[model samples]
Target chain A: MLRQLISANMNSLLRHFLILTAMLVSSGLFAQSGGEDFMRSMGKMYVVVAVIVAIFIGIVLFLIFLDKRLTKLENQIKENGKAR
Target chain B: MVKHWWKILGVALLIFAFTAGLLTPIRPGINDIQPTAVVAGQTVSLTLTGYNTDFNQEQAPKVILWKDGDHIINALGVSVLNSRQVQATFQLPTAFPLDEINELKVSTSDPANGFITALPRLRISGMEKGGEAAASAWTGTIENTDSKGGFTFPYLPNIYESVRNTFYHVALWFAMFTLFTLGVIASIRYLLTRNVMFEQRAVSYTSVGILFGILGLITGAIWAQYTWNKAWSWDIKQTMTAIVLLIYGAYFVLRISFEDSDQKARISAVYNIFAFASIIPLLYVIPRITESLHPGGQGNPAFSRGDLDNNVRMIFYPAIIGWILLGLWMAQLNFRMMKIKERLLENEY
Candidate 1:
């Protein structure tokens, strides 16, 4: 029963991830034509967006660093349990 | 949940800062003026361009050439070319009231949009010396127009709406500095107590501080690219901040180089103390003493009354607090994770 539930959750998560990726890709294509000029004409609102993106990336990178540390700890614990 | 009140507050303050900072309309101001210089004793038709101004409102706009408190010349005729453009004809006196050649400020006052003045654009020449009698030739009285009442950010030249980045980009540096201070405190505590917990805290805080410092640099570079027309200008503040981050970066390298935990903590604690000591001079002292393109350099002070007005201060202070709280929350989580890993390793041994 737990396995079925886990598989269902994973399927939905994958579906959502695919949808988000498609949307982003489509938006990227849409923004390709004169988007730079449009953003410039809007009094450089793009700079604010760029700054926000940089901060977001920085936070994500820190989270990834923490995750790696956790993974290392988990692997170390598994190794010790096996040895014991 | 009750213990997490600060986390909630941090998120709330950030929401408030982003909404208020980005959505607020900037005050109306003059962008440009045509025929910058004018001759004395002549009727000159001047074109005034405005930013975020509406001239065709129910109340007509007034134009004036202001020399000083006593010597003011009102436009003979005012005509609206468009919402953003106006034509005003000024009849200059044969001689300026103050001097032979006068640099007069052009002012546009509209009831809806408020008043904005161009900086010494209208130069009045052909005035003879000792024209103090011409002060009596002024005819129009300066009338005070009530500006539309609301909260608005001050309009600054060049920076324009990109000034909104202050809440994000600058707040990151403030947050980074707070984390570094906390890390230094933890380092001192570790040295005194020789406790592993405090060492964990110092490492976590310093790591998060470095992350924030990197983010601050990236955001600042993006802001400079748009405003200053360059991404990396080798600005003094930028160089000093990069050096500070590198100093802290070496702290992490120093941590991993040691196999024994006690030796590692002791050496790193001493290094952290010295690193924190260097920040004061590099960022605060040297930047102020040297000529820097950044604000707060040389004789100018950052966060001065003129640099951050009351409206910006309302959001800016909240943003700094929010970012600092968020940084603390991240560091705390990292510290807890380190403690858990250490516990697991101890149990295994």
Candidate 2:
């Protein structure tokens, strides 16, 4: 009897999985054939933005680092002048 | 006491008005309604939903539904299915010959009964007259028929309705802008007259602005995680907002890092000026130019989109104004408290 109940549960789970898979496939097909061009345009937009941001961030960080170094050097010079 | 008579009256009036507005439940609702879903040979279902009873509990509300200002469905068709069920669907006429905007109006309550009087409304679009053909064509264009089917922008993508966070996230920045604007004015006054009181005002506003900014970033990250599949995608807007925040955070650091009162005041004032200047572009300009997942991106129109109808604008504009005023009120109180502390210290000295 336990074996029969376990098989019944497994069969129901399999049926549910099949239904979900069918729905996904149908939706996926609709999206692929009709949605490709639009998705590509959008993907291109995101990639372009990501690249620009990466470059800008790099430059900003470089400037910040350069400023820190220059500030340190300026402080050292002021200290030297005081000593003299 | 005679000199302060106006002040006393003003306080009493303010208290009375606030209490009344709070007590008056003007929560909008739909009464009797009819909707025609099938106008112009279309097979679309129309449903109307809203709260039923008035806030005053005066009487069961009644509504009359009209098509093109013609009474098609009378108040009798407005059946209460379930006392709490707020939605009603109706079948549309096979052919609707209207050219202009179709309006839905919930009529005013019975004025004799002393209930709140107002007509809540919903609008049916003109394009619906052309039927499903027009709607399908419209959705097809918006969904983008090119590579990778459907709309490309994540914000518009069906998966990312989560982008409504744009209002809350962006609203926080607007609040920050407001507080910082106040800070700038206070800073200028401090510089002009060497008033430490003005300096304290500036500091208090900036502190609140920073708090709002941080909360904005956190909310933004939470929203980003749902749409971007990660908490921090480093989009241009995100990066810029973070940078703007850090710049102001630096102002606080500069103030605490120095012990000399004059030096702290001068340096912090200068830094605040720079922070405010950078914020305008960081929050407004660069995000538009760079690839942005945020709304108002290269392709996404920020302000004028079909999604945000006049109905949304009604609530949204008031919400922005209310939040900004609330921020200002809090900042003003902070300034007053700081002033009291300063006065106490002076007394001791």
Residue A22 miss distance in model 1 (angstroms): 21
Q: What is the lDDT of residue B56 in candidate 1?
A: 88
Cα lDDT for residue B15, candidate 2: 43
Ten consecutive residues with minimal summed lDDT in candidate 1 chain B?
A: B296-305
DockQ of every model listed? 0.30, 0.01
lDDT by candidate, in order shown: 0.78, 0.50
Q: Across residues B95-144, which tens digit of lDDT does each residue of candidate 2 receive?
A: 33343435543342332222221233444554235544333222211111
lDDT of candidate 2 vs native? 0.50
Alpha-carbon runs more than 4 Å astray in model 2: A1-84, B1-167, B299-304
CAPRI grade of model 1: acceptable
B269-327 in candidate 1: lDDT tens per residue? 99999999999998888887788767666854244347786888899999999899889
The window of 10 residues in a row where model 2 chain B has the poorest summed lDDT is B139-148
Considering chain A alone, report the TM-score of candidate 1 relative to the true chain A: 0.54
Please report the TM-score between candidate 2 and the true structure: 0.46
